[model samples]
Target: MNAIRIDIENVTVAYHGKVALHSASLQLQAGTICGLVGMNGAGKSTLFKAIMGFVQPAGGRILINGLPIRRVQKSSLVAYVPQSEEVDWNFPVSVHDVVMMGRYGYMNLLRIPRLSDQRAVREALERVEMWQMRDRQIGELSGGQKKRTFFARALAQQGKVLLLDEPFAGVDIKTEKMMIHLLMELRQTGHTILISTHDLASITTFCDQVVLINRTILAYGNTSEVFTAENLSRTFGGSVGDFSLATSQLAPGNQEEQEWT
Candidate 1:
């Protein structure tokens, strides 16, 4: 069997006496992009938060590279990008400042950014093609630019795994292409990536695997085998399903309050 990069076994979560996910289990291999599809309230964002160590699981554990996730944080092995709206945009900060924050967790409390950290930030920004806007205030940039800026931040973390919530929700075609290219390059570097998205078309072409989730794991495996219309219908049986929402509506910057984690 292939080596597992992330292992979520029999994990369960709840909020205020209500359950979100029940006995969920999944194993993601290293160096592949995994797409998550599910209806709203299906525990998708909750799952990502669990992996980020933001929300504690009520049962079971999440592991990274055969080690507990709590231990994995020491290496900065996992990085997360919540939806754009989740960020407090009114906060005064520049694009460079945002990207540089990724390095803080790796640095000593009193340590200033070293030459290596600056170089890494620049390289990451360049890869996302956001270097030209490096000094620009993040609030002034367009929607796509903001996404790219955060993506560069994730790249700067140099984490072995990246978990993104709606990376392609809002953006022009050019920006979407750029994001896809960056993700592919990361895979080549042996990074494991997981994205929660509603774009079935891109999932067909860009992901190595597809995980169908709705309050529980419906299916997970090769994209070709798991993203069947039957599976989609099963995952989205009601009009309230998350699939019906346009990608435009799902953007982190555009969604309703408390939609992102």
Candidate 2:
């Protein structure tokens, strides 16, 4: 049987008395691509944060590799690619520099990059096909290239698990395909991947498993079974009759908003 990479049992999170996630439990198995799906205010990112130890839950437990998340900095076991919009695109840094930062977790307080660290960074860049553009200023790269650079940064961590938030949002088709291929390769190599996205088409076809979140976990399992019209309607506050119509109303500037899924 595949080992469970992450397990959340009866977890709940709240902010200023407003509940974000309610008694949510989930299990992410090794070597699988699981997608978190739901509309805004669905509490997907909050669930990720809880698993990453960024926020402590008010109840229940989160475990990573059979260890309590609070005892270990879960960041070392799982890599995170936060939403692109969460990053400052104007930051004055090179692609290589950003990728090398992933080594900080292994470094001491002095945090000097060693030869092995540089090699890992280089290999990570190569893995993402961004080695040639390593010296370019981060701000000068295209949106897709920038996303791949961060992805390389996460790869440099060499963790057993990966988590990405809206990775395919606002990218060219070629870059999207490249990212998907890389994710598939990661899965083949025994790494567990959990991605949160609202792209129902990709969820329907690309993902091995689907999880619907809306202030709670509505459904989770194989995509064919969990992404039903009934479940989508329950989690999305409406039917899947016209996902694009509802999504269009919130697309233009909604990227910058603090939404769940």
Candidate 3:
């Protein structure tokens, strides 16, 4: 359970010659749900991109299961659920089609879905309770449904590592609960999950580990130890959302100063 699933060492990512993330490093263990918590433009997405092989780090190294991301991509060992805004809702595609796309790695040059691919897609949709809506247009679903459909796509890929970006951002409470439950189940099956989130209050609820980031990593480790008010305040540079710092760790005046929505 403690095996290192993702290894990042002294990584730095830049866009168009502008530094976005610098010297960020983290080692995520298998069978764990780690929360990547930070404020807006905190480079959480950039780090995820770097791990997914979307953007290469200008320096340092990132390894998934001791191999590079390119190899991982070829084996479908890592599945990604991007932020909602990153997708175009107007795209003409069905839920089933999107889920089947995950199996493309397993398909031949013509991209024909074999019997196993079809079965896997169906199983994935059922796992997310979206089988009934598989034929529905992807854009016609609710926010929660969209998230689930995409998550199902990831599952269909049979990846060992799952990187979900802002999964709880625009979903309802029911969707949030369902997603959390599914994630817990995956952890039990030895899947490593890294979730990038801005909702600080929810990090400790489900995460076994927490990473506090503001461009570079501020603090990271066991959630109970690293998700402290002091570290969080430092990460956010102030209070954010409906969060109140605990008095036992910080002075009352500091606590008051750190509490805000």
* Backbone clashes, each candidate: 2, 0, 1
TM-score of each: 0.91, 0.91, 0.89
The lDDT ranking, best first, is 3, 2, 1
* lDDT value for model 3: 0.83
Query: Considering lDDT, which of the candidate structures 2 and 3 is the better prediction for this target?
Result: 3
lDDT of each: 0.82, 0.82, 0.83
TM-score of 3: 0.89
Query: Model 2: C-alpha RMSD to truth?
Result: 2.5
Inter-residue clash pairs, candidate 3: 241-261
Pull out the clashing pairs in model 1.
85-252, 85-253
Q: Which model scores highest in lDDT?
A: 3
Of the candidates numbered 2 and 3, which has the greater TM-score value? 2
Q: Write the per-residue lDDT of candidate 3 for residues 33-72, one digit (tens) a residue.
A: 9998776677878888889888879999999778888876
How should the candidates be ordered by TM-score, best one leading?
2, 1, 3
Clashing pairs in 2: none
